[model samples]
Target: MVKKYTVAIVASAMLLLTGCSQKSDVDASAQKGAESADSKLNQLGAGDGMMKLSDEEMKAQLIKDLEGKVESVYFAFDKYNITDESNSKISANSKLLGEGKAGELKIRIEGNCDEWGTDEYNYALGLKRAKASQDAMIASGTSADRISIVSYGESNPVCTEHNKECWAKNRRADFKLLP
Candidate 1:
């Protein structure tokens, strides 16, 4: 009887130990998963851990924000000079560039002209308009080295109607962020 009782007690102890070991293994697995989640959250700029976004999601958000900061300044008919309103807008762009909000991105100033002039003349006028905007940005604080100029001439019209208002809209300088 003593031998049987000792055997029974040993079996029970072995079973109990096996169960505890399995539980410990499960706890360790859970801890590893939690750590992985925390690491992903941190990479996405989520310190508070309320929500987590993937790397691609974070990148898209950043790109959208940067695009919204881009500004376009318009020009008067037969003129490449910057108006007061356009100057203020260019100043804002300069501030953004100087503050590093736009990162190390280069800018393209696209000059466009109304359809009233000959192709060659319109092209020159468009280039002048682009240069005017570029100069204003530089004067307001943007680095001249990071800017480029292009003239689309009267090729790309924002409004197709043959009207004064449409022509005014067409004679404009567009800003583009280059890679």
Candidate 2:
């Protein structure tokens, strides 16, 4: 009975000692960090930090800054190779991308095709065309990381008329800018 009583007393004393211990520095620092983060979030919500633009505003700004500055690279029918004529266009685009706001923006190369081949074939061809343009841009000093490729195939045709001129217009790679 005495041993049991001593053990209970010792356990109670240990509990009391632990309960009375001071908070650790880690706990205090964590609390301080949480408060600092909350304050920063509040400041950001109140627009005290850098200005943020709305999606529409950003799109308009991008259009204003880069509309028609980058030209579409046209490819020959049933071909994905960058021709001699397209080199001039690629060089001009690289120059534009190297300077001003265009340099900082990410580029999307959209590959388009005429309604001549099967959907699968057109998609593949379009992808190849986009890849070719991407390679050309990289060769002309544009960072490959900044450029992305997408193939719209025949779904996004610039001209819908079933004619040579219209099909020629549709076979192209167009550049888009992203924030």
Candidate 3:
């Protein structure tokens, strides 16, 4: 009976001590959390300390960085072959792609056409133009896997005016960076 009484008292005392320690631990954790939150608030109030960039700011920075870097290669009427001038432009872009300075971004080749043919025909022509550019880029040492081609035929014309100049402008392959 004495042994049983002693064991019960000891268990009670241990539980009591454990309860007190757990409460203090919780209090300490709460205090630390408050301190950390206050520090973050202070940083935000000071207009500094690693704040997230606004969307506009991020967009502006991206545009500024990529400005004039992307090159467009134009195609002749009903032609899928890359012209000499377009090949030169592709060479320049290939160097940029090979250098790895643009990070792990995928390059999108957008193929477009003049509004003279049926939608199906134009789409095929656009794909051909894009493939020509892709082939040239790959030949110039760009990784084939890093490029993707999309054809937007007879649609999304850069110049809405129905003229030769506008048509010429529309028959082009454009390069875009994708994250």
Q: Estimate each model's TM-score.
A: 0.64, 0.66, 0.67
lDDT of 3 by residue, 1-179 (tens): 99999999999999999999999999888886463546655655555636778766665566446636868988889998998999999999888755644535678899999989966989999999999999999999888898999999978689989899999999999888765
Q: How close is candidate 1 to the true structure, as a TM-score?
A: 0.64
- How many clashing pairs does model 1 include? 0
Off by over 4 Å in 1: 1-64
Clashing pairs in 3: none
lDDT (C-alpha, whole model) for all candidates = 0.84, 0.86, 0.84
lDDT of 3 at 153: 93
Q: Report the lDDT tens digits of candidate 2 across residue range 1-179.
A: 99999999999999887766645655776786463546665655555436778767776697566757789988888999999889889888888877875687888999999999857989999999999999999999999999999999999998889999999999999988887
The per-residue C-alpha lDDT of model 3 at residue 142 equals 82
Best by lDDT: 2
Residue 124: error of model 2 in Å?
A: 0.7
lDDT by residue (92-151, candidate 1, tens digit) is: 877875654365667788999988986698999999999999999989878899899999
Which residue segments of model 2 deviate by more than 4 Å? 1-59
Model 2: which residue pairs collide?
none
